[model samples]
Target: MLTNRQRNHIDVPTLTAVLVLMVLSLGVVYSASASWAYEKFGTSSRLLNSHLIKVLLGIGAMFVGMMLPYKIYQRLTKPALIAALVFLGITLVLGGEMKGATRWLHFGGMSFQPSEFAKFALLFHLCALVSTKQELMKDFKRGFIPVMIWVGLVSVFVLAQPNFSAGVMILALSIVVLYVGCARLSHLFLAAAAMLPVIAVYVLMAPYRRERIMMFLDGHSNGKPNYQLLQGIIGFGNGGLFGVGPGESRQRDFFLPESYGDFVFSIVGEEYGLIGTVLFMGLFLFIMLRGFRIAKYAQDDFGRLLALAITSTVTLYALVNASVALGILPTTGQPMPFVSYGGSSLIFSSFAIGVLLNISAFTDMHPREQKHGGQLSEAATRAAASDFGETSARPRPEGFVELSRDARPEGSVEPLNRAAGRQAGVGTVY
Candidate 1:
């Protein structure tokens, strides 16, 4: 049901960038999963086919997110947060365990991690709260505490699931969002400092987690190079400068566990070498840069914050996953955003990018959109700015659009459409 006009409104370059990653994901997953599939299922393409299906479903989710108006998300923020909490609770009670962690729920032959959805939902809730309560952000009790409460609750549930990585990811993301929303750095620093001991205890208290840390520090076990890390390093070393060549990775032959999942980046290094690895990383870098530009030019504060938060989450996931594969950091089981072969990470990432594209559509005729036949018009500009206030002050600023930092919330009411459709603004939250 997509029209040319709507399609044209998408940010083509960012879309192209993500599409490239998705394509590479399919290729790498096929290559990395081939041996595993054959050994486990007597067929090489079984896992590849499954990953393809997930990719297709993820594409559908992405488009759905893109077509939905960003403001409707604002209106649904509260309910969405509640739903996320409920899902997390349900996951704790009924989730399936893998590798000693209960992080996934299976229904009707499909499974996904609730933490993925919770991460995005929390992002939405935080953006709404910070944008609407900008006035109270400087106040510890009124602004900071309220937002942190939601963050703390989410973190607690995720940690209770024994998913330390996800819990910490949410906590770190919340603090970053708070800082970006103009919360006092001193408060954030103190908060982080206070949480350190708790995080430390949580890590040290877990047998597996404590062992991983010790192994990381010792860098060896029983006078042997750590099996997983050694295999990954050998994979990269085998890649040398150019690579061993596509589909030629020796590591995928059962040397590396979960090559198609957590350590897929090492497979890339083994197959494509440094050149391919650089190109692969370059694609992610492009997404990050383009995502930030979208946030910079977003129509309103909420849109900007949402875009940035999404971008940060994806990039952080990529960074952490890659670092772990390279043995630069202790393994955290975080998957590479779009490249890892998993349903939840891929689907959630696709959905987030779709929302980013929707926000970019309103960037006062961003060149990327125009390349696809969208136009920039004064009417669109005015419509985009209406949420902030009547800005007859001057012509729309060139390039990226942003709201004034000092803009205050004016008490007024107007009938505003909280969707793609235009409506008169009741009262500007700014």
Candidate 2:
């Protein structure tokens, strides 16, 4: 049980990032969704209102996640992983398909994406497993094989849904966790080699996938696949150095499809400009650095693994999102952490931040000290006395007496008059 003082020692860098991103997201989402809202609901504020509600709900979920003891996650890891897999299966059976991908489960009016939660749950389980098997990680059979099988199962299911981007993200995330967990470099290299042919086949079999790669590498000749990329680039160009100003983006007005989802960065660049984009990039880098620092200084193996898993997951997602926005990779439906307009992504991001905060609580740079007000005051007083060259001239409390140099014997260097005290039957005085 962490005391209040102990809990306060937890660094909130991730939380700070979350707050900044949320504010930016809310403003941009409002602007990006306004035109669509007006067309659908006959009111421009409808999307903004709904997004505000989602933000409030996400914040509430974050509060719960951050307040829960990190140890509780250990107990819940197995169950959570199972539940995530079950939900993923359910999504395949009854999920809603959007843009030809079955990623969301719709119940009544609410749609939930299981993949978002699955990422976190998989992280939790992997961390727990790796922490317990540090020695085994170096062994191919006990460590690499099991983890690969586990990830492969999930990947097969995700790819079966034809959500190639999600599958790729999951595979990347698992590889990162394995690397951080100290799997042999040779094993990773071998695995990478093995994956190449499969990746080639997958790409060759899917015409759109292959087209995306070609368009990404060569720029579309007919500007068919490059339309979104060109629009995104134009958004950034229009803003110039400072920006066109918030809510003034011409691109978000039906010019950039799904501007509020994966390409929210375009809206950001269009509205906030080059400066804003740089700032956003800087914030994400700072967050990744902070999370790595937390993982590096975590107190125990479990904490270290947990921190690494969370940090890697967030970092990978951010990189993929940026790559997609920059047209270095095909655009996927992955949302920018905290900056995209989606309930599941936002909630999962908050949860990941919460885990990072939990790891921060146990860092060694801030050691646990006595927290009673009186004890702290006493320690401070003693420190101040030492600083001021004060001498102990008065009698002190029985258990709190201060020893003097002169209390030693004349010919001996012993500070305590042990011999004299023993002779006097008063026990050794110190």
Candidate 3:
């Protein structure tokens, strides 16, 4: 529902970061895809034009997400999850194969990967539950079981598609969001241990996956299975500290497969060298920090958790992709967020950024808000205000007591005044 004109409230800093990344993505995609596109389609502009269109569409999707109130996401959580489940199921049954994996569902003239939407849908549901059921989160039976059912439901279909990397991403994202949501750490550890065997079996059942793992562990031996990894490393090594120069990467000329998609980071390294890659990573780090800042000052619990989940997911994907490209991890077909030439990844990332900026817009970081000399901390005041009516004359919630703001900077985590809550016998409402 959000239109560009109405999205003035979008967080300018985060928006700036996203725009810069998108520009960089455009440049990289153009450079990285030229050779591959020219060879495949007999026209150098084919992939570049398609990438440009996807970028524009992604920007539009971002603005739409920014225009809508994030609270709407909470309402849509259940239906969105259900829809994703159905779509993933349909993809598993009837989807055509790409790269030996049935991960995309093709329609008349278009295609979509359901897992992309499902990722965000699942995160939205997790945030909604975490925000609404804070107290219950500490209990394994009541908290962990119900939430993880959705995680499992999504993961089963993703793994069934044999998209092992995406399956791992979904499970990892769920675990991280749950941890951030305050699920018991011990239970999480136990759950992870229990999952190891299942994960092993899943990996071994597929020869390619097992080979990938083995290659990852011992890439030095012959380097046959790790041809892609070796080629990527060679690209980076060729760049050295300064790089070979933008749009001049030799690796894109068929030496490294999928250079414009999953291995785009190698293109970045080969072209820009270590300095460029470092600066690129710094941008992602900036986004991560800015996102967490917005989460810290979010208007409510839902906003806080939602922002964190979205931020974590984006940063995690970027990090993992870069790691794989650098040979720090196994090849995982995970695309570099904004830098990769993938419509699904780009659009989903843009949408997440849009929601994050919206949340940031509602945060209380403005000088005017800080000028109000009330002793109550911003978070306590906001939460309590929501609990009671906005009007001060409304009866205060029973046992409610305001706590003074900590002397920390804006968007820093303030220690919960648990003593005050204990004295009030409310046992930490927010």
Candidate 4:
């Protein structure tokens, strides 16, 4: 049995934000998946049913993760990394491909994107390594070299799947974690420079990727990849300031491809409009801020690094998804955090949330100690005064109090009582 205080460890703001995203995801997935479901299963809500089932599973996973000690994750870091790598390797060998990319691993009647789990595992492992070996992190040989080699290996495997977006995400996340862990700026710059040629070659080899980049730079004329982008723009334009209404998106009627996944923002724009987008963005920003706060005040190095990695990964994904929908970046297969339709993405994101919640449990002030119903209002001076009072009241000499106070305070106006001190010093006021 869990007490209400224990359950409240789930950060209310973060949980609420995720729940809002989940509800929106369900709605958009129902709309976008309707056609596919009707065509395949003779029902419009088949995808919805599957999505609901996954949501339940995700919720269960999240609860478990929240309850588990963050220290346990530190212990499992190496194993998780190895397992993720093995899964990625298996995906390359036996994964299914769609659009010239093989990123999914299918087993039995179910399928999942291994890259998603890989991201989490990598974060976990990297956090453990960096946090545990802080002094070694500054050394190029002991610190960065090994991590870079592992990063290269991970990147190569992901690239072999031809998932450039996921590779980019992995690199971005790694860099962010390293940066937060206090890696040298020069190392980051050098790493970025090294990756340039690799990115160029990848883009040059893939004509579709090149064309997508060109289309992003120059407006689309053929209406192929541009079709969805155009619909997204229209959705925003029609939305004006407020919106049309919930579930009343004009773009979802076969105009936008992937209306529930990558382009779910457009549906949000169409139905809830500018206000909703702003609100959603605000929520995400709040999560990022809270996550950083957790990192800043973490109890240990591992907790700090874990919070940083998790927050950075989530923030990066949100940024990329938003950029794609706004036509600022080439469209990639990345899904919106909780707003996407995929089971794997949702479950993994939920798991990440669980990790964040766990961190929050340790970072936040204890509920019983909070002032004004969980508000952090205790002043340092007040706390110190209380401690001083308690210490003074304990069984000890009066001279000890004077010494302790003099040692602790930087400056004090009260003069030492010579007569009282002399009496205590002579007679021993214990």
TM-scores of all predicted structures: 0.86, 0.83, 0.85, 0.83
Better of 1 and 2 by lDDT: 1
Q: Give one digit per residue, the lDDT tens place, for model 3 in 23-64.
A: 898888888888888888999888888888898989998887
Give the poorly placed runs of model 3, Cα more than 4 Å off: 1-9, 220-225, 368-430
Candidate 3: worst 10 consecutive residues by lDDT? 401-410
Clashing pairs in 1: 297-401, 408-430, 413-426, 414-426
> What is the C-alpha local distance difference test score of each model?
0.81, 0.74, 0.80, 0.74
**Which candidate's TM-score is highest?**
1
- Model 1 per-residue lDDT tens digits across residues 64-170: 88988887898888798889899999989999998788888999889979999888999888988766665556667766777788888889989988899889999
**Per-residue C-alpha lDDT of model 4 across residues 1-430, encoded as one tens digit per residue:** 2356656655678777777777767876787668757877899899888888888778877777777878888779778878888999999989998888888988898999888888898888888776555444556776787878777888888988998889988998898887666666677889999999989999889888887877787766355557778888888888878989876777877788778788888877778889988877777788888787666545566777787788877777887888788888888879878777788988988888888788777643233445666554443233344445643322322321221123322233233345653442422111
RMSD of 3: 6.8
Candidate 2 runs further than 4 Å off? 221-225, 366-430
Off by over 4 Å in 4: 1-10, 221-225, 370-430
After best superposition, candidate 3 residue 290: deviation in angstroms?
0.3
Candidate 2 lDDT over residue span 1-430, tens digit each: 5668647767766778878878878898988888978888899888777777788777877776666777778768878877888988999998899867788999898889888888788778777666555445557886678777767767777777777888888888888777766667788889889987886787788878878777888888356658888888889899889999999999888888878888888888888888998898888888888887787556555677778778777777777787787777777778888878888888877877877787777554344344575464444445345445553422233222111123332222222233432343432110
lDDT of 3 at 357: 85
